[model samples]
Structure formats: C-alpha cells, structure tokens
Target: MILTGSRLEVMHFVGEKVEGYMKEFLKPVETYWQPADLLPDPTQENFLEEVKLLRESARELSYDYMAVLIGDTITEEALPTYESWLMEVEGVNQADYDQGWSKWVRAWTAEENRHGDLLNKFLYLSGRVNMRAMEQSTQYLISDGFDIGTGRDPYRNFVYTSFQELATNISHRRTATLAKQAGCPQLSKICGVIASDEMRHAKAYSAFIREVFAVDPSEMMLAFEDMMRKKIVMPAHFLRETGTKIGETFSHFSDAAQRLGVYTTIDYIEIMESLLNEWQIETVTDLNDAGQRARDYLVALPARLRRIADRTRIPTLEYPFSWIA
Candidate 1:
C-alpha cells in the first residue's frame, strides 16, 4: 500500500497494529517485575539484614560505576519530558482514548517508569548515592528538557527511540556485567531486567519503522538518514547538577561510562550497524533519488563512524560528582 508521503497516515497505519506490538513487547503489569520485587521489602522481617547485605555489595562498586548509574537513573527519571514530547507528535492524539499511538506511548511510559524507580531505590538503599543531590539533578533534567532533533515527526521520533533504546540496552547490559564482576548480584539482576525491557522496547520501535518502510519507503529512508546526519542526542544531554550548567554533569557522566566500557563510541557505531541490518537498509526498494542517497549515506555511516571512534580517547580524569557522596 503506497502512502501519500503523509507521515500522519503512515503513523496511523502502523499504530493500528500497536495492540499486537504491545502484546509482544510489553508484559502484563500484573505479572511484570516491579521495583519492590527486586528491592528489600520494608515489611520483611529480614529487611535490615537484606539492607546490610545490599550496602555491603554496593561498597565494591567503583566510583565511575556509581557515577554512571546515577546518570542513568537521572535520565530515566526524565520520562515525563520524553512522554510529553512523544504525545505531541503529529499522529498521536492523547484526547482520543482509542488512538493506538497514544495507547502505545502511555503503555511504554508505564513500563519505563519502573526503571528509574528501581534504580533510585537501589541507590538509596546501597548508601552510595547522595539522594538529595541526585534528586536535584533529576528535577533539573526534567525542567531543563531536551531537543533531540526529531521535532514532531513520527518517522524521526521512532528512529530516535529505536536508536536510544538500543543504546540504553547496551549500557544497562554492560552495567549488569560490571555489577556481577563487582560481587553485586542484586544490582546486576536489576540492570539485567532493565536491559531486557530496553531491548524489547527497541524491537517494538524498530518494528514500527519497518512497517513504515513498507508503506513509505522513501520517506522512512529519508527520515533515517536525517536523524543520523543530525546525530541522535541522548535525553541525558540536558542533565545538570545544582551548581552546574545544563549538560555539564553529563560530560563527566559520559566520560565515566566510556572509561568503564559501559557505553562507548564503539557501542554507538554498533547500534547504527544493528539498525541498518534490522531495517535492511542496503536492500530496501521503492526509494526515490533522495531516498536512495539517504540509504547510501546510512549504509556507509557505521564504517565512517568507527574510523573516528578508533581515534577518540576517553578522558582519564574523574570529575567529582555531587551525586556521589
């Protein structure tokens, strides 16, 4: 089915299948894991003992790890900004209860809400985070907001989410591995579950783009190219501390992540390569001249990025984060 190059129409076409996407990607809330499930229960008889154990394990975590975790938590806490932005996308009408796009956004938000909650609670119990400082940063991030360069375009929005979700998945997965290596199994489990959610969400967003490519190949290809050309800015790009300017904290946080190998330039290149493969950019048909050029640019982006990444060096200096006491 050829679309009129209307992104709204393409969104509606794909939104119609959101119910199936939700079923496949998002789990029923009743059965899904909650923050309390992974955390020490205040009502439990052994709560104090569990807390002690948690703190003990947390002590083994490196300073860089703590900084990265705090940054990740702050980013997740800015969900309100993300949801508000997505709800305003051209095809999503929050007033329409039956709008599939709106439903997907709400459901996705609900699932994502657990990530920050779980991480915040864990950090608090671990006695490693400066709760007040972290809370302030979270508030600043939400209030500061962000411009991810997607504007209100659904095609660009989905492409951004697809890339962002995969990036989060890599960071979380690596954090989990590092957690286990630090002898913090609880934190590892927490990061592992969150990573799983990210991967699932990534698949859903990628599927949306896949369906779009089917009906609006040229437009979808162009959108993909445009986002890559502008570069995908992470939500945490707006993160800040109490005395710091916007994005100041994020620079240090990013360096910590890079140093720890939790998330790096290599991961970014790999994500681009994965998306190119996932959408079969090289083989996509029905593209106009512009779309063909976009596809050519995208197909070559990973290699180009990797050569630059090879020369990039992670900062060896560690900035003293207010979030870490």
Candidate 2:
C-alpha cells in the first residue's frame, strides 16, 4: 500500500512507458483520416447509401480515434495522478508492488480506442471536412492538446471522464446539427446514433463515481468539489486547438446539448446528489471541521441549483437550464 520513495520512481517509469505506448498506438491509425469537409453531402437522400458505405469504410478510423482519446487523456491527465496514487493505495510497498496499475491502464486504453476509429472512418469515408481551414483546424487542435485536472489521481480521473463523456456526446450531437444544417441527413443520423453511445459511456462513469461515493463519502465530496472548481475542457482540442474561445466553444455545445434533450441541469444535479446521498457524505459519523464545511456546501447545492435554474429560466421557459439570466 503505502508507496515509499522508491516505489514512486517505479510508478513514474510506468507512467512514461504507458505514454510511449499510447504514442505508438496512435501512429498507423491517424494517417487514414482526412479533415472534415471532404466527406459527401448528406442533403442527398441518396446519402444514406453513402453512410451505409461508410459504416464499413470508417470502422477502423473510428476505433483508432477512441483509442487515441483514451491514451491521450490517460497519459496527459491520469498517469501522473496514478503515479501519485502509488502513494495513496493502502498496503503495497510500491517498489515491491507488482505492476497491477499497468493492467488497469491497459484495459482502460483498450476500451478507449473504439470511439475514434468509429468516428474517423465515418468522417473520412463520407468526405466531410476535406476543406483547407478545417484540415488546419484539426492539426492545430490536436497539437495544442486538452486536459482535465492535475495530480488528483483516480478521483480526478473519474471526474474528467464524467464530464468528458457528456462533452463528447454534445460534440457528436452538434456535429449532427452541423450536418443537418448543411443538408446532410445521413450524417445527421449517424452523428445522432453515435452521440447516444457517448451518452452511455458518460453515464457509466457517472455511475461508477456514485458507487465510489458509497464507499468513501468524504473523499468523494472532496473529489466532487475539486472537479467542479477545476477547469473541464473539450478533448477535441487534443486534435484541434482553436484557442481562448474554447470557453465559448463549450458554452455553445452546452446550449446545443440542452436544446437536443441530451443531458440537462437536473441530470447534472441528480448525478451529484445521487453520489452524495449514497455515501451519506453529509452525515458522516466523524465530522472534522473541513469535512463539516464540505457537508454544509453539499446541503446548499440544491439551492444553488435553484438559483441557477432561476437565472437560466429553465423553469420559466419550461426548458431545462435554458434560462441563464
């Protein structure tokens, strides 16, 4: 459990190795992907046939993108925290500890590769962004990179993915919107379907955190607060770095998500409250002063949500979180 100094060194090395493996994994797959514009127009109802064609053509690229996403996030965001977690785990001396964490890392990576390949193959075979500026955007974003949190470890890891899954869902949904707006019915349908898959992934992580809360209430709350306070950005920047407007970019996506009936304000609150109540974090038997403060904050979260709802006009407009005053 407790990682001595020497064990920490091993973790750092493992982290480095994992990062290298991620880079290696990304190489062959990304090559086939073209920028967004070159894809076929969905305006033609005949485009459905094209989409069907892509279902076969784009599968590998879609899989690879998902792989890269998982690897990049883990390497850039989660690995350092795990390195810290070598210290957090309860019993094993890290130096003597077998490479158990790496196994978790690999499994996680395997699950991630699926999304990218699915999306990329679809985009390329469809000939979506073959244009110049769009192609440049892709390069710029990936080079700039995006991240979720700092040395927060598995806790931060959970938080990052919780938000990420939703964020990615929104992106997929918006891509659908763009396709629809561009008269591409086929692309819209494909994106809508893919977005649903993303929503499921996000929900899985959210549920996992809820389970985590049941076991370690205080730690969960601390992690929750940390997640909220820290910046949560879109991972697309990993492939397409635009710049300061990212905050605006996320806002636009959030607005789209609300309009689409994907995730709503209540969804966010429900996820948070479910974890809090399941853990009975607010009612912990041993309440240190800091923990007590956190509990107070947790108790007030609903009222905070109420104010946000009021400001956003979610209730007034009969729309969810739509009334940001």
lDDT of each: 0.94, 0.48
Per-residue lDDT of candidate 2, residues 203-235 (tens digit) = 655655554444454555666676665545445
Candidate 2, superposed: residue stretches over 4 Å from native: 1-98, 127-135, 166-217, 230-251, 263-266, 277-284, 313-325
Model 2 weakest lDDT span, ten residues long: 316-325
Error of 2 at 324 (Å): 28
TM-score, every prediction: 0.99, 0.52
Tens-digit lDDT track for model 1 on 1-325?
A: 7797577777878888999999999999999899999999999899999999999999999999999999999899899999999999999999998888899999999999999999999999999888999999999999888999999999999999999999999999999999999999999999999999999999999999999999999989999999999999888998899998999889899999999999999888889999999999999999999999999999998989988988998999999999887
Q: Residue 319 deviation, candidate 2, in Å?
A: 22
Give candidate 1's whole-model lDDT.
0.94
Which portions of model 1 miss their true places by more than 4 Å? none
